[model samples]
Target: MKVEIWSDVMCPFCYIGKNNFEKALEDLPFKDEIEVEWKSFQLDPTLDPDQTKTTFEYFREKKGFPEAQAKQMIGQVSQMGIKSGIKFNFDKALITNTFSAHKLLHLAKKYKKANEMEEALFIAHFIEGKNVGHIDTLVAIAGSLGINTDEARQVLTSEEFNDEVKNDFSEAGSHGISGVPFFILNGKYSVSGAQPVEFFANALQQTYEETVIPLKNISGGDNSCDADGCSI
Candidate 1:
């Protein structure tokens, strides 16, 4: 089974969703047969990559939330992150464009390390508060994933994988996905938002059963043998 996740690194719920989805995958009998692909989606594509606005400031200024309300909302999200085994430091988070980070993810896809790259990007943004949009940070992340730093730098410095990232954006639009952490199981079932582990597990199980074709008993019981007796 293949699972495609449309996520944004800067989105707090995306990281939480990732953890929940992985936890669900852990107990699956067909976990080894599952393939996961990370697709990019930008919540603020117009944000300047060079800007150094904190997430709190973005919420207050851009989202029109009051200071206290913004802090309270962020606190709530932080609690959610904690529940998902993540430490989300919104105070340290910078609101920079994730387009470059998405491009780097496409580069990682070439090495079959996109999922690892996504996790690293999420940590950099939500936990470590690193500038994921910066080329230096992305190259460092790529190197950590066993991807060649030079190649990673070349991709970041140039327009490499730009189309892949844009295509992911287009695909997300086509799927009418306006939020992060959207999951498509086997290209059939869609699960939106950072749902609980049980929700993901149920979706995975259901999708697996629906996608996998059952063997047809052409002979029926005419020539079948039972545990108690054989049909002769």
Candidate 2:
């Protein structure tokens, strides 16, 4: 079964959800048969790539959130991150456009390293407080993932994988997904938000059972048909 996940690097819940989903997969007996693909989604596409602001400030200024409310809301999310084993430093997080980052992810996808790229980006933005919108930052991240630095730079410097990122956005819209951390199992079942581990496990188990059929050995003992002849 294939699991497609739509998420943004800047979204805290997305990272938490990823951790939970992976944990769920770990407990499954057929985990090796599962394939996971990470899709791109921008929570705020209109954000300026050069913009430099803390997440707290961004929420306070752009979202019309009061200072106290912003801190409180961010604090709540931080607590949630703790439970999911993620340490979100909203205070140090930089607010910038994720377009280039999404493009980088597309580049990584070609190497089957999209999941690693996604995890790196989440850590960069939410933990290390790095500027994901910057090409140099992206290049360094790509290097760390064992992707060719020059090729990654070339891709980021140009419009490579732009359509792939846009297609992910378009597909998400078509699916009526307006949020990050949305999961689609086998293109049939959908699980939205940072749901609990059990939610993902159940979805995975159900989807696996429905999609993967086991072959039954119907041959009776000493009465099975062979390539030469049937033993009746």
Candidate 3:
């Protein structure tokens, strides 16, 4: 089955949802046959690009939450992240504009390493305290992923993939998505949020069983990650 996920890189729940969904996929009966897509969704499109504020400051100001409450919310998320083996430094994170980040993700997809880059970028921003929204940092990260550094730099510096990024956001709204971590399985079943692994597995198995003819030809040596039904 194909799975399309709409999420912002800065979203803590999206990260958690990603990890859980991966775990579910790892154990799926048709793991090799399933495909996954990560679509772009901006959590805050109107955020000031020139704002040099930290993530905590942005949350406190934009969300209108007190400092203590924001920290508490972050702390709870951190605990949840620990359970999923993803670390989050809510104190050190900065909530910058993620539009550029989304554009880079599209470029990564071309190199066939979008999934790996997505996970790395999420951890860099939310856990490693890296400035993912920064051009130099993104270029470096993309380079580290075996992508052409110069090409990555040009893409980040130029207006490359800007429209594609917008289309992703537009498609999310077209699908009635208001919040992130939204999952559309096989262009049919839809699930939202970073739900438990069981939820994703059940949805995937149920959908696939309905349409696919299970190939019993298992040579114990076949790997396929197709995007036909997937929506990354």
Q: Looking at candidate 2, what is the lDDT of residue 85?
A: 92
Per-residue accuracy of model 3 over 80-110 as CA lDDT, tens digit each: 7888788788777877788888988999989
lDDT (10s digit) by residue, model 2, range 26-135 = 98999999999999888888789988788767777777778897777677777878988998988789989999999999999999999899999999999999999999
- What are the Cα lDDT values of the candidates? 0.80, 0.82, 0.76
Q: Output the TM-score of candidate 1.
A: 0.89
Global CA lDDT computed for model 2:
0.82
* Residue 187, model 3, lDDT: 77
Q: Write the per-residue lDDT of candidate 1 for residues 115-164, one digit (tens) a residue.
A: 89989998888888899988899999999999999999998888888889
Supply the TM-score for candidate 2: 0.90
My TM-score estimates for the predictions, one after another, are 0.89, 0.90, 0.88
**Winner by lDDT between candidate 3 and candidate 1:** 1
How far does residue 44 in candidate 3 sit from its true spot (Å)?
0.7
Off by over 4 Å in 3: 211-232
The best candidate in terms of lDDT: 2
**TM-score, cand. 3:** 0.88
